[model samples]
Target: VNYILIDKFQEKFGSAIQNLSESSVISLELNGINISRFGKLCWLQVSTKETVYLFDILTLGYEAFDFGLRRILENEAILKVVHDCRFLSDCLYHQYKTSLANVFDTQIADVIVRKEEAGGKWPDKLRLLPECLSHHLGLPAAAFQKYSVSRQPLEQASATVWTMRPSHSALLHLAARHMPELLALRTVLLDKLMVPFTIHVGHSLDAYR
Candidate 1:
């Protein structure tokens, strides 16, 4: 995992953005106080299969997006796997004037999977990231203890904790952990979706025969 602050702005972050642009698919996670249109968006975690980058929105500000990140996020050719993009989308569009494109939202996918499993009834409630991780990845609680523990302290702390400069290790750890799990969850959900999709297509083909 790499932390991209003002010191590493030009070289490190620029290279990361370039690499993200080149990749066909990547996972994204955003952290902030509230993370809605009116709230602060402090850190952005972008991950490929190999590397994770934590971009410090507090330190680098809009330059972080303008430098190259915006292009990648808006680029339709690049697929971004994220969990529940509503708030992320709101924050980006309202604050940064950036519209996300080609996004695969895992939360929505999970809902669709559940709806299919229930014979087309929509789920009553949306699943959070941990639940999605457990349900899709088949990971036990012990497997994700580190991630859970890392997030709990922040949840109890003040919202301004995200806006704090020189972020704490716990916050950084939480940011670093989400992308890999999200990428894994995407793989599992995609596989699950295909089973139903394939069956539906096969039935449609039978109608022609």
Candidate 2:
């Protein structure tokens, strides 16, 4: 998988995303560092059918929220697929006051397709990302563990890690692996869901309609 770092974001953003047309679909994976204490988002990983783009938000800071990036996320024509996008949603709104326009959160779709229990409670088995990926796509448990190892260090690392180039390369590799599996998982989940899943009126994602 190809990777793009923040130092090159401005120069490469145009060319990297130029192929994203009106009908293109992109899978997204977002990771943040020190969320409760500082709420700093560290990485933004996006993947099309052919490529992966890793944007280091912590490195870019407020510039990461520039109009071009905003336009892509806000674009109604390009479908953004995220796993459980709660943290990503919170960061987007907190940083940019932007509500995602066209999004499909796979966790919400799974809940809807699995159906409510007799008492109208959602079943919990298929909720988490690793579980869904493993069950639906047969990804090994070790893969998730390795991803966690590669990511947890970056997530919990000191703020200086973002400024250091060598510290982030492996993290980018792990982050890049996420979107491809997500696309595969989405296909399997959609097949199981067998219908379109709709987001309710509230900003929070839920399984309704």
Candidate 3:
């Protein structure tokens, strides 16, 4: 299988009507944009003819997956957008989980919290941030804990995770390597809005629509 990896790219198009003018490869007719942020929407589309997927680093979710996997799952030409990217990634993780297969900072934070759960070189600014709220309210890391945890640089983990299941392992490492080490633990959604919800709460990602 061709393991395509794209980094720092977007798949945005103004509208189906507008994109139609570009190339048959480019179009705006999408199945639907499930969850989105920052003015970008994440959509999932499929065709019986083929399946397409895109691994652009900027946007690596359903849109790219649908487009890149087109040949495997469908034959119908895909209609994709290319605005900011990542719009779909935010939601796709929640929607597809395993099918979409991705990880991010929120996820790692949640994991470590269950263990250390708090305070390790976090930034003062993040302390009040809505996303990191829960983190602070909860017990800081582990006081009398026996296990060991270390907060490091994200760049450092990026190189290591690749050797062991790059995708999942890398993201796991990334979460631990957070910049401030800990987000202020602002909001409860840190778990809801992050990988935990996507990995545990969401439905079978294999059945992603």
**How close is every model to the real structure, measured as TM-score?**
0.90, 0.77, 0.21
Better structure of 2 and 3 per lDDT: 2
Off by over 4 Å in 1: 1-7, 146-157, 204-209
TM-score of model 1 vs. true structure? 0.90
How do the candidates rank by lDDT, highest first?
A: 1, 2, 3
> Per-residue alpha-carbon lDDT of model 3 for 1-209, expressed as tens digits?
11122333334322221232333333111212223432222222311112222233234445543444333222234323221224344444344431222123343444455443243443333222123433444544452121122212221342332223234633433222222222223134354446544665456765665
Error of 3 at 40 (Å): 21
Q: Tens-digit lDDT track for model 1 on 1-209?
A: 45443325767877888889899989998888888798888888889988888888878888877888899999999999998899899999999888999999999999999999999999999998888998888889876787676665654465678788777776787678768778889999999989887999999999989
Per-residue alpha-carbon lDDT of model 2 for 105-185, expressed as tens digits? Answer: 988876776663224567856566777777678878897887555555766664335445554466667778778778787
Instruction: Sort the predicted structures by TM-score, highest score first.
Output: 1, 2, 3
Q: Cα lDDT for residue 175, model 1?
A: 76
- At residue 32, candidate 1 shows an lDDT of 82
Report the error of model 3 at residue 173, Å: 9.5
What RMSD does model 3 have? Answer: 17.1
Q: RMSD per prediction, one decimal? A: 2.3, 7.2, 17.1
Instruction: Give the lDDT of residue 151 in candidate 3.
Output: 19
